[model samples]
Target: MPSLMDTYIENREMVQPNHANNLDTVHGGNVMKWMDEVGAMSAIRFAGKSCVTARVDEMDFRRPVLVGDTAVIESYVYEAGETSVDVYLRAFRENPRTGERELTTESYFVYVGIDESGEPSPVPALTVESEEGERRQAEALDGLDA
Candidate 1:
């Protein structure tokens, strides 16, 4: 079994001109790409196998990350089935100098563990062992109801 905390991952991307739109803000697609990458990493950590994205739930962008800001993507596996790992992901716009951060986007993703032949593979059971891990799992479950 793998603890939910074991699947946690955080990645940061610098928002540069190439990753931004004409308005000088990070593009929505770029944000999604970052989130997806982080989410997949979490799922793979939990599954211990190659994982392929199966589905992405509704994603909402609450704010734009301006160019020069750091895009911080955090993800963790909150739940899992026989072969599917459910990951919760959130992205924040961080000011490197001030260390201030604000939520920019969030989404839920599903990834299926795969074998060498491309068939679904079983994943170890996920456990929420710590108080913080339990809280995070609960929060992700609560968001699913909203």
Candidate 2:
């Protein structure tokens, strides 16, 4: 089983023209798609099996990620059950010129492991055995309200 940090997956993509709205800010749907993809990556890495999105507990856009800015997505496994894993996803806007980044979105996603037959299956235990890992897991679970 992958540990806390080891189960993390990230992706940084540029906000293209089609990814923006009339105001030139990244579209909310596009951000949600990115978050779902990155969260799936973490879930797959942790469970080592095919998984499906069971539910999105909450997704809230704190700020807009503008076009030309790098959309940095960070995701990790926070909790796991017999056949489900909870993932915490965060999106940030990275300025190309200053190389600074700021949080823009946050959400918690749940995925269920699937077997070769496409049926839900149990996943292995997760290891959150470090100080930072424990803190992050706790922080992610602080408020499911998003």
Candidate 3:
């Protein structure tokens, strides 16, 4: 079994001109790409094998990340089936100068583990051994109802 903590992943990307839209804010597509990459990392950590995106449960961009801000994406595996890992992912817009951050987006991503032959493979069971992990898992489960 792999604990939720073991599957945790966080990444940061600086929003540059190339990643921005007409409003000089980070594009939604770029944010989605970042979420997918971070979510896949968490899934791979949990499954210990190559993983591919199976589904995106939902993606909501509540706020925009400005061109000068840093986009921080955090991800963790909350549950797993035989070949599927469900990951909770969230992004924040962070000000580098002030260290202030605000929630920018959130999404749930499902990944399927694959073997060397590129076929579906079983993933390890997810364990919420820590109280924090349990709380996170609970939150993720609750979000599925919304």
TM for every model, in the order presented, reads: 0.98, 0.95, 0.97
Which has the greatest lDDT?
1
Give the worst 10-residue stretch by lDDT in candidate 1: 40-49
lDDT of each: 0.95, 0.91, 0.94
Model 3, range 22-103, lDDT digits (tens) per residue? 9999989999999999999999999999999999976989999999999999999998999999999999999999989999
lDDT of 2 by residue, 1-146 (tens): 67988877889989999999999999998999999999999999999998899999667789999999999999999989999989999999999889899999998999999999999999989898889899888889785643
For model 2 the TM-score comes to: 0.95
Cα miss at 61, model 3 (Å)? 0.7
Per-candidate alpha-carbon RMSD to the true structure? 0.6, 1.3, 0.8
Model 1: clashing residue pairs? Answer: none
* Tens-digit lDDT track of model 1 for 1-146: 89999998999999999998999999899999989899999998899889999999999999999999999999999999999999999999999899899998999999999999999999999999999999999989998998
* Candidate number with greatest TM-score: 1
Error of 2 at 24 (Å): 0.2
If both were scored by TM-score, which would come out higher, candidate 1 or candidate 2?
Answer: 1
